[model samples]
Target: MATTEAVKAKTLLGECAAEFAGTFILILFGCGVVAQVVAGGIGDHDSIAWAWGLGVTMGIYVAGRMTGAHLNPAVTIALAAFRGFSWRKVLPYSLAQFLGAFLAALVVRWNYTEALNKFDPGLTRKSQIVFSTLPGNGSTELGVHLWGGFRDQIIGTAILMLLILAITDLRNTAPAANLAPFIVGLVVVGIGMAWGTNAGYAINPARDFGPRLASFLTGYGGAFKDQWGDLYFWVPIVAPILGALLGALLYDLLVGRFLPISDEDEEPGRIPEENTSA
Candidate 1:
């Protein structure tokens, strides 16, 4: 039994590592596309959006079996808080995700140094830097951008979380298994179309912070810290948690409450049969 438990522990560790690697790839490819397209490089809006969407779809499918593909720390925290996941697992999962994202950004920098240098040789110091929002005009204008961006992220994340909870239901789990990646990708696409202009549609904190940190370290000579004063970083981090909680609670009230079993799909309890033998 002890040996079996040890093996299980090793398996979990492997799963965690895979999750981190998968998430890192997702961000590197997805955000790398954005940097190429939007940050004064060669790509276009449609191309960048498609890249991000495809990256997310593929990442979820690749990592779903192992870590539930929770590349987003907000998703991990919300699940642990509301879905009876062990809280103890949340920190390690979040840490792994952040590390993966940071490493991925580094990879993006290594790959794109030439393009970045060509685009802005004067700003070549900003090469490995991933994209995030800065005040487009000035501090007064920043408020409007932040509000709109926060609202969009909140709504988009709420819908995504709602879909996640519904898909994970035992009765619905099969369909969710088939549709989860597509649904998630579509959600990202919509957010990009609608909100990408303002705050870069950073619906996931790990997605933003990890790459931001990576860009800071490898390129831009650590200029990523300059954007930290925008006073809205918390929106990306906090609003997603609120949105996820809202989604899980709303899903529970609407669908979960009506189900025979409140939790997993094993049914509430078993009935005992009486024996008639003398």
Candidate 2:
């Protein structure tokens, strides 16, 4: 039994490593594109959108088999809630993911320091969009509203989680031949095109918080305190987690009941029953 416990620990370490690498790849491309496009003014929204979509796609392809490639903390928690993923690994998985995104953001800052300095004279909120998301319509409405940003984030993340479940639901028209990740990437693209502008469509907590923390440490200075000065940083983190959970539970209740037990690896990231409280 001691030997078995040791092996399990080793397996978990490997899983954490896989999550870290996948999230590193995710931030590398996703933040890289945004930095280049926004700070350098060399690309457009289309480029930014495609870059993140491809980032997620490649990340999944790299780590899907090993750790289920949950590069987002929201994804990790949602899996634990509904899919019987081990709750014991949640903190480890989130830490690995946050580290990956944080490290990748540092690389992105290094690569674009010159451009950033040139474009952003004060390195203030004007330059933060490259690293952290802020609401575009934070003060706009039929008149002037403040909570629109939160609503936008919730909606965008909900859409993201909904598509993630739909595309991977094996009992549904789930893609085969290892194409699920590719399809998932397209769903990301669709979300960006549809609602990305609202609050930068930060559907992943690690994807935003890690980079935001990195930005604060590097130059942004009090990154959570607000690029605009209102300290709305909590919106992205809380909203995405809530949205992912809601999306997953909604899908499971409405659609999962009709579907048969999945034998495929892409069964919404569920762990074996023996491994879970189920």
Q: What TM-score would every model get versus the actual structure?
A: 0.79, 0.92
* Per-residue lDDT of 141 in model 2: 36
Report the lDDT tens digits of candidate 1 across residue range 119-183: 76654324332444332212243555556656766776777677777765666553543776777
Residue pairs with backbone atoms closer than 3 Å in model 2 (clashes): none
Best prediction by TM-score: 2
10 residues in a row with least lDDT, candidate 2: 137-146
Badly placed stretches (over 4 Å) of model 1 are 1-5, 39-41, 122-129, 133-148, 173-177, 221-234, 259-278
lDDT score for candidate 1 against the true structure = 0.64
Error of 1 at 196 (Å): 2.3
Q: Write one digit per residue (lDDT tens) for candidate 2, span 218-241.
A: 878756755346777788889889
Write down the TM-score for model 2: 0.92
lDDT of 2: 0.81
Candidate 1 RMSD to the correct structure: 7.1
Kindly give the stretch of ten consecutive residues in candidate 1 with the minimal lDDT sum.
269-278
Per-residue error (Å), model 1, residue 34: 0.9
